[model samples]
Target: MPEKLTNIRNFSIIAHIDHGKSTLADRFLLHTKTIEERTFHDQVLDAMDLERERGITIKSHPVRMHYDADDGRTYVFNLIDTPGHVDFSYEVSRSLAACEGAILLIDAAQGVQAQTLANANLALHQKLTIIPVINKIDLPAADVDMCLEQVEELLAIPRDEVLKVSAKSGMGVKELLEAVVARVPPPETDPAQPLQALVFDSVYDVYRGVVSFVRVVNGSVKVGESIRFFNTDLTTEVKEVGYFSPGMKPSASLLQGEVGYIITTIKTPGDIHVGDTITGYLRACKQPLAGFQHVRPMVFSGIYPIDTADYEALKANIAKLRLNDSAFVAQPESSIALGAGFRCGFLGLLHMEIVQERLRREYNMELLLTYPSVIYHVFMRDGSMKEVDNPLHMPDPSHISHVEEPMIKSQIIAPATYLGAIMNLVMDKRGICLKTDNVDHIHVMITARLPLHEIVLDFYDKLKTVTRGYGSMDYEPDGYETSPTVKLEILVNSEPVDAFASIVHADRAVYRARMICERLREAIPPQMFKVAIQGAVGGRIIAREDVRQLRKNVLAKCYGGDITRKRKLLDKQKEGKKRMKEVGNVNIPPEAFVAVLRASDDKG
Candidate 1:
């Protein structure tokens, strides 16, 4: 069966973060009559509440739609949505590889951003048919023509190729769809080959397990057929097969030139690989497809449980959570003090957020997540162990001779007027300025190489503030370099507060310690019993604190009918105490913990 390529259009929506990709996806879904008009209000593809609240597309979504043209010819549209953040760049590449074309959504006001250039270049690299669309024309600050001009200049594409449509107003949307049908080529559909599909994205449903969202490349799929994930030897019978028109819609089976989902009954993320192809007959692939290995896990983190009590639950939840996302690699990890935690590997930061959020939201598990750190190679005396996720577990110089801290090629775009401020900010964050380009006298594009650790300094908010919301960042892991940095442990009453341990460039430990104390004073609550906080290099405390009485209450009045009020007051205090962390007889508030965690940030 040769695919109905003339009637098929396979493409994806690509854009910068919050440029309205998901919103436009919903509008397209509505136009295609795939979803009800009034159902989805926010990001439709951002099915997870965390994604919607965070305002980021954490995963790529594959959907199928049918559009009835004015010419009365019905066309099947397969739209895949990709994550915009630099963290999910690998995932985005995979998505782009799967699609023949991509819709570049640009905010009418915020022209071509770093991501805009990055994703567009990715599309161009893959030879993906690119159609530029100007979104948010309804925005008061929208400079639609200017944005269109920028896209043309950036890529040297024709102005007519760009579609100026406001996804919000439903204006110019039909024309955008028409552009898609005309410009983007359809998928190659030939059923002579076995049923093969590329998994762009997947999610774990407790009832369904690993429901792999796939874009079929060749052949056909049917229920009760033996199938296999090419990367993993695991094979299972296709228990159920369905198609997605944004929402999961039941289908008898999907053929070539179709996008659908299949439930393998194999319930684990390890069993599913993103670029892994699916075949009708098990072990049918002669060789696995191309562009599979480019998606390397870039960022690493030591994910721990707050309470040792949650250890078992944490392990169980992570295992269950991995059933869908193949990008997550959780290895059994532990610390003498932190008991048990997973050295979780992720494609990027949003991948981390999705994993952590899924654990809490779906599995109902509590997570004590440490700062995300990359794997650093240390050449040790005996041998070498690749340090993954925990800076506290960093091999000392006695254990390791040399080290490599992962670096990122970071690019930020902002108003040209703020170039000096951004330059100072990036330089302060240990960034090596590569170059800066002025965008039409108003916007500035700055490129730099920065250690991934340098970015954990709460620069996201500060970047917005410094650039007056005119700046945006896009970065990808570049390479690793030898670093002379060391960790400084902050101890509270001789017990290492796991969350309080901070990492630094190691030159200014005393300055960091004093700053940690001041920040802790702001973060830690006034306590009933005086507690001492010490920032130490080894067992010696360079900085220390002695907290005084917080229970100095003057109970001057004891009214006759105020016994109930006093009991309620006591109960309220008890509730407050319950909320406050004991922290070795020291009641610490949550804000205090975060404040200490972020105390070393570049505030000036």
Candidate 2:
């Protein structure tokens, strides 16, 4: 039947954030009879409430289905789902590389944005058979003709080649499936070759450590075979091989041109990684199949607990969390103030937020997150090197002797009216403009080389504010470069507080320092003892504030009571004294530490 389903389609839905990629995939799942139609009024494959509530897919997953074409024939559809955040760009690339085709979803009303262009570029780079689909037609803001024109002009494809569909209303989905069957070629086959499967994405199962999702490029995999992961020489016997049916129904061994899961009892999550090659152990190491590449994380930030007591708990939770999420990375990091957190790399800012939110929500651990810091290589006085994780830990420019910072190639799209504002903001952020072009109705595309550290904190918010929420910024972390920066440390009572340190351009250091002081004033609670706040530079205080004492002391008294009340009052005062934080000879309330630590987040 149809060459043993080798002529079947294996494709992924890829798009920018909030562009209805998952929504459209849900529609496909419904139309294909994979699940009861519209069973999930909410997102279908976004099985977790966390994912649906956030309206973003954190983990990549594949949903299997069969679509009946107007030709009255069936095609097995392996719809690979990918993350929309740039942090998962590698994951997106891996998913795109697994398939022969990709459906590019463009919002009709908003037209093309920064990420749309990016994902389109990645698809074209992988030489994918792209079917441009314009979605969200039900909205009054829909501009089908305009978005199609943008796609045709930007992607250099024919306008008529693009398909129009309303993913939300489920209109045009059947035709879209037909277009996929007609235009998208079946998986390339060379069944005789030795088995070489690409592990595009994977997750950990409680019973089995990692259930890796693989796309078989050649041969076949059966149960009880000796298999080896490319990156890891670690060999394991395949416990079972299962292919995805219309909605994960059980099917025996997955053959060439199939999407399926492999249950290997690999001891830990570290054994499995995305984009790894899973090949049968043979007489010699067989060459990898046609498509695969290494994916690099573009952004990084440190995650630490607000309370030192929660440090181990945070570590345990992060370890557990990373098992299922192949993208989340963690490494030990220590700051003078924060002690130990993780310097974790991500694909983008959205990726960082997702990890942080999960840690807070899922684990119920309150954390004091320093401004997300990018990786920077610094040359020290001892002729050695250190990778700066937290900007707070960045040595003084003088002590650093010489410093280099990371820079990223960024693209910004904003309305023509805000071009000036955008330009000014970019320049202020130390961005070196690369190119400027006018597109749809004075929409301007400006490319700039920006310091990764500059935008590590709240660049999105900053850009949005500057452009009145019309700024669309897209960046893939490039690499470290030499740049001028000053590391300003925030202090309490002249003692260096590593949590308050940040890296800023030399010119902007003063303003940032003052602003940090103001934030500390808001964040640092009025304490039992007078506490001083200072922003220090080169071990010298640049900005300072003195938080006054609590309006009332730890006075516990009864209006009409016996001497026993006095004893009770003494006991409370002793207990309260024991709970106080010693900040440079001042006994601050326990809540004061939490208030100050969580203050930065509040301002955020």
Candidate 3:
């Protein structure tokens, strides 16, 4: 192990979405000359195609760089880039746990957003040194003075001390890098102690198995040493150890206070979980690191293959993906309408969308996803309680007591002009306004307590619409609350479809049911006979819509016939229609299952 741990700095960039975090990271790489100018690209840390397309970072990327400061010394800097979306806040937390400091980036024009405060709080809770940096000063709308005042006001840092950088033009980047080394303290190392590495993140490699990203806090790890995960109790010999020079490169060993990757050739990604502690088998640490909590999936939905024959393949692919992503959970489930499939749980809607996109793009499989739902606690009449994530598993209302739904503490930052619209939108989703604060005369921050189920739907889109894309929001689990709720089921031609069932608050059930019925009426094709689309709560029908049958040519063939003959023909056609209504099946379009998600108006 190196004796001079003071030469190393471990830090991450914490910022709001579209605040030029990835761009700053790119500037850092360029300043250090880590990658050649010919090979340089925008958002290099964002490796996924989806990330590049969406202009966001979906995964946490760690890279090591060497920078020569004007102080006559070279330093090793480990920069961990994190995702800025609320859906990946846990990822930010894990990244912060591995760093000793964080570079708090705020847009010069946009100022500090809701996520900026949320991430700052997270970094402060970790006892990390924060160096405030204002980015994108090159823009015409840039308000550096205003941003500096806001930073000093919110972060309590002196206005003149905060660094300013234009990540795109490379202005002030050198000073920013030097500020990281001068302002942020190096990791405290104790190489003589037993091995105690914190596994902050992990990813799967088809050829090498599970690659664990760790910060060696106490001792060191080598390729031939036997290591055990404190959480899983699984022991294995390290196949390889390396550092990310933006890409994996083999290293002899990782020392104390150094961040690197360890390959254990562990086939099951679930076994080598994130937030686990890694220690040498011969000299294990006395206690594991703190803040190690298993990720609980908040939102869930059913995912079935478009073709039934791909069911087994989809299951296999999910298992493989789960090996890499421990936050994603799936269990075997069967639906009458969707057939054999799995009920998958995710951190949020964005996470769910990413997983579905990966399944389609990486695995080349088409899928049908049911409406997203949150976990519900059901109390039964027999003094028993069960937690249900899938609406299919919901118990009968007759045997159940009241239900409780998950709630979240949400924060929104937007222009004051949209305050009324935003509040109305939130309240429509059952959100209770808690408080409001003025960041400046033009911007305001609103805090609210809302049902998690509501936010998992189109709440975000509605928020964006109401605020004219100037608003950003972040949320955390605020616990659960008891609400009058019931599972609303959709039936087509008197047959219930489990895929269209949802547990909704009693006050909104009628509106939601009507919306679903109306949407189904539009999505379902006209049948030979009238088809009844009904939404029911238990056995009581709450909303109904009928699809009128297509007009037949039964009377068209009767040319100049007697009136009695025409009546007989019409009577025969009516009798056939009655028989068809009894025996005919309604073939619902796939869009009908997701119609509730498209319900935009409150009237329903």
| TM-scores of the candidates in the order shown | 0.84, 0.87, 0.95
Model 1, 366-410: lDDT tens per residue? 666655656666667777556645666665546767667788888
The per-model lDDT (C-alpha) reads 0.76, 0.76, 0.88
**Candidate 3 Cα errors over 4 Å, as ranges:** 1-3, 551-568, 594-604
Best by lDDT: 3
State in Å the error of residue 143, model 2: 1.3
User: Candidate 1: which stretches are off by over 4 Å?
Assistant: 1-3, 38-42, 70-72, 189-192, 280-283, 294-368, 382-385, 492-499, 520-533, 538-595, 598-600
Error of 3 at 242 (Å): 1.8
TM-score of 2: 0.87
Give the per-residue lDDT of model 3 (tens digit) for 253-341. Answer: 99888899999958778887667899999999888988788888999988988788999999999998787788999998898887899
Leading candidate by TM-score: 3
Clashing pairs in 3: none
